[model samples]
Target: MPLLTINLNPAVDTVCRVKSFNTHHVNRAYEVVKTAGGKGNNVARIARSAGEEVYSLCFLGGASGAWIAKQLTESGIYPVSVEVGEDTRTCIAVVDERDNSVTELLEPGPVISQEQQNRLLDKLLDLLRSKTFDCITLSGSLPKGLTNEWLDQLFAELCSHDIPFIVDTSDSRVLDLLHHKPTVIKPNVQELESWMGTAIREENDMIQAGYDLCRKGAKAAVVSRGEKGLLAIRKECIYKVSVPKVNPVSTVGAGDALVAGLALGFINQLPWPEILRKSAGFGTAATLSYTTGRIDSGSLPSLVNQVTIKKIQPV
Candidate 1:
């Protein structure tokens, strides 16, 4: 079965490398890379690289939108795009080589009109009726002009389907949608803290936060903690996943990579421990690549082996 990824607010991501970035000064980039980017799109790309058939459903407009579609097609991902009125957004990430720090400038993407929103929903529904997907991932921020009702309808429709879906986003509104009971909810440590409105300073705090999400409505919560690896929580058990340290090239899409791994695991019905190992492996491999949403595929096996998974007592 194929993976279907939905990116409502997609972008053309531009990554520039600078020796030492100084604000308020002209710093010429020594290297630049551009790729079709959006959290969902990244998941699609990584899953495709892992030999999974992937479909990317996204909103596109103008030249940037066309470019993104083209990139996806070239990447072996089938594109199911809905045309919008305004151009898609372009996000820039400046990587400062001095300390490997990244500075990001993100544009508010095109405002999706009511008509466009309906069209996207209709397209998605039609696709769901026509094709069967192993897993569907809804990722990234909601585009401007989308109303809460629109999201409600989207989630309602998704829930009506039998296929499992994962939600990976930074928007706090995810808390509001937990009642829909997505198969999994993925949030980074910072995103989880923001949603819970509390700092997670200790391992217990992190486990408690995961439990809170599950208690509220999420069937499962996978919290990504940069180099510390991941904390995966379910109603029955919790897991502490750790990956070996590596010199990172960019951490931009590591979370998305992890989501892709999880999707793949669910698709294949892998054991829970194997799932976390694969997910963390992909995330760690992503840190070895400079591209926004890609991972070093060759390093995945070794990384997966190096991943340490331990069952943690729920707080």
Candidate 2:
């Protein structure tokens, strides 16, 4: 079964490496770079690179949107998209050489028309009806003008078919998805804190929150802690997964790859231990590269072998 990716909010990625970046100063700097990106698009790219068949569903418009479709197709991603009225959103990433700080300029996604949004949803369901998929991944933010009804209806379809879902989102919408019991949910440390409404100072507290999330309709929960490794709760147990330390060249898109790895593992029926290990390895490998949302396959296998996932009972 192929992996199906739904990207309601797509982006055009522009990255530049600036030396001694200064604000309010006309900075003469590195060459500007652009790439096809968005959370779901990146996940599909990583999943396909891992030797999985992927179908990408998104919204694109205008010349930039046309270029995005061109890039996705050229890169071998199957684009199932609908045309909208406005241009697609763009994000600018600046890498500071002095301290390796990356400043991000993210534009809110273009407002999707009601008709186009409905048609895209219809297209997604039609594709799902025509092809059976190993898993379904919903990544990134919901665009403006898309209502909760839209997401809820989509979740209903997933539930009716018993297709497992893995979602990466942060908002009140998450509270609604809980009723649908998504197969998996990945939240970073800060997002977890926001949901928990308390400071998570220690390992035990993190584990407690992971369990709470599972109890709240997530079949399995994974919380990513930068530089601290990942905490996973599944099979009525929690585990801490770590990898050989790498001085990360970039932190962008690491979480998306991590979720992709987890989704891929679930599709392959990999054991829980290996799934967690692969999740950590994919993330580490992604950061090993300097570019945003790019993970080289050559670095994954070796990194996978070095990751260790320890089964633990929270103290």
Candidate 3:
């Protein structure tokens, strides 16, 4: 079964390479690259690269949206988009190769209308009814005009459908959907800290926070700690994962790649340890590439070998 990824707010990501980026000064880029982006789209791209059949559902508007669709097609991800009135947003990422850092400037996407939001929801229901999918992933932030009440209803519908879902969004409102009990949730350290309303100062703090989230509704909570590695917490078990150090070209899409790996693992019904291993490998592999939301499939085997998974007592 294919993995369905939903991205309500999509963007054309422009990555510019500059030796040094100085604020308030004119800076020239040595190279420029653009690609389809958004957390869900990134998940789809990485999943496709990992040899999984993937479908991306998103809103497309104007020329920028059309370009994203074309790019997805070229990347072998089926784009299932709803046409919207406003042009899609563009995000800029300045990569400083000299320091191996990336600075991102993001734009709030086109404000969606009630009618457009309803249309997108309808399209999602239509697809869910028509196709057989292994899992569904809802990523990125909710666009404008999409309210908490609307999401509550939509999540209720998903619950009724009984489809396994993985949610990887930055929106705080996502916490409201936890009652529906998504199969898994991926949140970075900062996002997790915000949601849990506590400081994640160390591994044990993160593990406790993750488990607390599982207690609320999620079957599992995967907390990403950047280069520090990830902690996956379930009700009874916890897995601590660490990846071998590597020179990262860019860390832009590592989280999305991790989500993709976790989705694939869930689809295949792999053990939680294996899932953590795969997720860590995919996330680390993505760091080797300069492009956002991409990984070298060939490097996965070695990377997977380098991932260390330790089962710890649930905190």
Q: lDDT (CA) for every model shown?
A: 0.90, 0.83, 0.87
Say which candidate scores most in TM-score: 1
Write down the TM-score of every candidate. Answer: 0.98, 0.95, 0.96
Q: Clashing residue pairs, candidate 2? A: none
TM-score-best of 2 and 3: 3
Error of 3 at 205 (Å): 1.7
Off by over 4 Å in 3: none
- For candidate 2, lDDT tens digit of each residue in 1-315? 599988888889887888878999987657677877788988988888777888889999888888889988887789999998888899888878787778888888889877887898799889978999888988888888887788788777775666768888776477667767888888888888888888888888888887877777888888888777899886568888887788776788899889889888889989889888888889889887776557867878998998888888644
The alpha-carbon lDDT assigned to residue 135 of candidate 2 equals 89
**CA lDDT of 202 in candidate 2?**
88
Error of 3 at 190 (Å): 0.7
Positional deviation of 212 in candidate 3, in angstroms?
A: 2.4
The order by descending TM-score is 1, 3, 2
RMSD of each: 1.0, 1.6, 1.3
Per-residue alpha-carbon lDDT of model 1 for 1-315, expressed as tens digits? 899999999999899999999999999999999999988999999999989999999999999999999999999999999999899999999999988889999999998899998998999988888888888999998888988888988988886777778999888877887888888898888887798888878878888888888887888898899999999999999999999989997898888999999999989989889988999999999999999678998888999999999997655
